[model samples]
Target: MDVTVIWAAIIALGVLLYVVLDGFDLGIGIVFPLFPDEDERDLMMNTVAPVWDGNETWLVLGGAGLFAVFPVVYSTVLSALYLPLVFMLACLIFRGVSFEIRAKANRTKHLWDLAFIGGSTGAAFFQGIALGAFLQGIPMDGGRFAGDAFGWLTPFSLLSGFGLVATYALLGCCWLVAKTEGDLQRRLRKLVWPLTVMLLGFIALVSLWTPLQDPAIAERWFRSGLFWRLAPVPMLVLACAAWMRWAVHARHHRTPFIAAIGLVLLGYAGLLVSLWPYAIPQGLTLWEAAAPRESQMFTLAGAAFILPIILAYTMLGYWVFRGKVRHGDTHHYH
Candidate 1:
């Protein structure tokens, strides 16, 4: 292991961790509309309130890892994704404000909830667009994006954006099933059927698009044996997703959320197989964009210890707040 490889692994792990942890909370926001009544919405918000902010720790780590290990890549990517990045950040701000305003304001909490939903949907979709564009490779000059501001506004990117929103909504709905009880659980269960169908459909669309857009991907996928190696990931994901659907229908709330988390893990594993060694999909390999060996080693020293502490704290938080949030939920700011 080279220092660059070590740092790349660290960065990739951080991104995956962020996705698995924060994704459901974001999903919850996205699916807030699916709930029938106002109280259900509040309960969904309450379910995520305790742990959502904490889940963003991995996002910070991922951003910092990129700055430390691959500043060139970061500069290029951020430049390329300037508009989508702004959209994502704006959504995050609106979401945070929604959380704050909803708790503080008594008469107009509904507005805040709507704000949160819009923000979450906007953020998640724009992020997917960013992913689509990165995979599609932007033209670069001197390690910076050399294209129009609307460079990411492609048909494929928009489709991926919506797909991500759908995925998050499904994740959120299942999370509600897990942490909620009574009416909320029932409502979430109702969502499982339609959402599962949407999830499968989105995956199918992405599968079709991937090979068509990048023939090299299809070639590499089947030729390098990576596809076979990674086949178990999607197989396990689908199996778990099926079990989750069944669990939701069977009125087993907890199992569905667990299965949903397993699917998220499986998705990350599949991505690792799909795009290993590449920091920017088809364009930049991790080693090519990685910082010097000494710089990477220095960052690892801090990351090695900090990441475990963050994980421990997150797990402990979940352990402590392991229960359904009732309609009349109180915010206990820690």
Candidate 2:
């Protein structure tokens, strides 16, 4: 197989992992305002505190893979998204600091809580904006970003931001339903239907908007035989949504979370199918953006060894922290 395709797959896997793993934690922050009770907030934070940082490992891996395997693409995207990217980093830093300091100072806990909410909102919004901008295609001249600093701002990008916020919030709500017990779980159960309905609406909006944004995408999706073959992607996602709604209503603890995760995975797969071969939407192919074969091979060698270790550690962490977080469990990370 070509090294470019190999690295692309690796990068895709890393990205998928990051979105699913870190997504629910970010969602927790998004839904923070819903649970005004300090005890409930603590329990919610406790559910994610141990695994949150570990969940970001895939993000680091994905970024590094992009840099190593597609240096030109990395540079172009960063240049194109300089401001949003910087803001995202700041948001992530603020969010991480809140986790540490919120536990230290009683009086300043409220401030930290605000930071967590703001940071998560900023991070998720900008990420979705970036995704929308990328899908619409970045302006490029000779493989370099040619657009102004505010080129990424558009109506579609803004809508994408809100959509992602809803997606993450849904994931967070489902996660709470799974990990928590008693009144907290019951409250989360009440939220599931609304969040799921909102998510389905966003999915519908994106589904309508995607093909319309680009003729190539429209042709690939609606004008080809592939459309019929790939129709099951959205169908499966809808099924997951239905299953999650039922599971939450039925009070099947783990099933709702699993179904929510499956929904995200299916949505991501659909996006990838719509954007294959192109590294930067309509701008460049994977072969064009990829580093030289020698460079790719060298990085591939290191990634081959390192990725498994990361995967094993991730699995071990989940296993060690397995099972429901009982009410008043002091074993949770503070």
Candidate 3:
């Protein structure tokens, strides 16, 4: 078997899982300001409190897997995007600390709330910026990053940053809709249509903007037979949006969240399609950036054993915590 391809698939899956899993929690922070009622905020935090930290495992997996199997990509990409990545990490740390402390805090709860909002918003925005910068292509010299410190700061990257914030907020809103009840759930459901519209706008902007910014990507999408084959992606996105709207209108609790996930997956697939085979967009291919065969084999063996264990535990956690969160529930994170 081509362990390189296998490893690539593994890393791709890990990153996608990370985005879908942790995206909502970070999103909760983004949407935190909308529902200012202290009890509503408490309930919002409660929906994710059980699974938020656990959801980040995929991130660790993706980052470590890249560092291990594609050190060249890791080093060069990290170097090129160092500032945004550092800011993203700092935001994640602040968000995590605030997530824990906010529950216990009384007067200082408001402060923690602000921290949580800033942290989550900062993290999501920077992540999108990193993604946009990477998509636009990293300057490379002798297999090293050849970009300046501010290379990642661009109009395209800034748009992507805000787009991601919208995406997460929508995701968080859908999650709250599924996991809360009564007035909170009603408010969340009300927010879902507008958030979905905002998210779709961002998706459309990114989709159109990316190809215009990168001729290669433009050609990839429109200049060949690949276009016809890839046509279903956007169609599917619209279908998912329709499904989410219907679910919200019908008051079906779980469907909107599921449909929201579908939208994220489709967007992710489009991105992967755009950047296919390139570890660093317009730079290195996966095979070209791969570590030695023996190292891949060793890591694959370890991943084979560990991934199943992680999957099992993650499934168990969700199953155990399954059900709508209501106010005054004694079983919450607080």
Return the clash pairs for model 3, or none. Answer: none
For 1-334, candidate 2 gives per-residue lDDT tens digits of 6989999999999988888888899999999998888778888888888899999899899889999889888999999888878888899899999988887769888999999999888888888888888888888998789999999898888888888888888888888888998988998988988988898898899989988888989999999898998888878987888898789778898888888888788888888988998999889999999988999999999998999999999999888887788656734676
Residue 39 error, candidate 1, Å: 2.6
lDDT of 3 at 285: 92
Question: Which is the winner by lDDT between candidate 1 and candidate 2?
Answer: 2
Question: Can you give the TM-score per candidate against the true fold?
Answer: 0.94, 0.97, 0.98
Candidate 3 accuracy as TM-score: 0.98
Residue lDDT tens for model 3, 71-140: 9999998998999999999999999999889888898999999999999999999999999999999999
> Which clashing pairs does model 1 show?
none
Which rank order by lDDT, best down to worst? 3, 2, 1
Please give the CA lDDT of all the candidate structures. Answer: 0.80, 0.87, 0.91
Runs off by more than 4 Å, candidate 1 = 328-334
Relative to the unseen true structure, what is the Cα RMSD of model 3? 1.0
Clash count list over all predictions: 0, 0, 0
- Model 1 has an lDDT value of 0.80
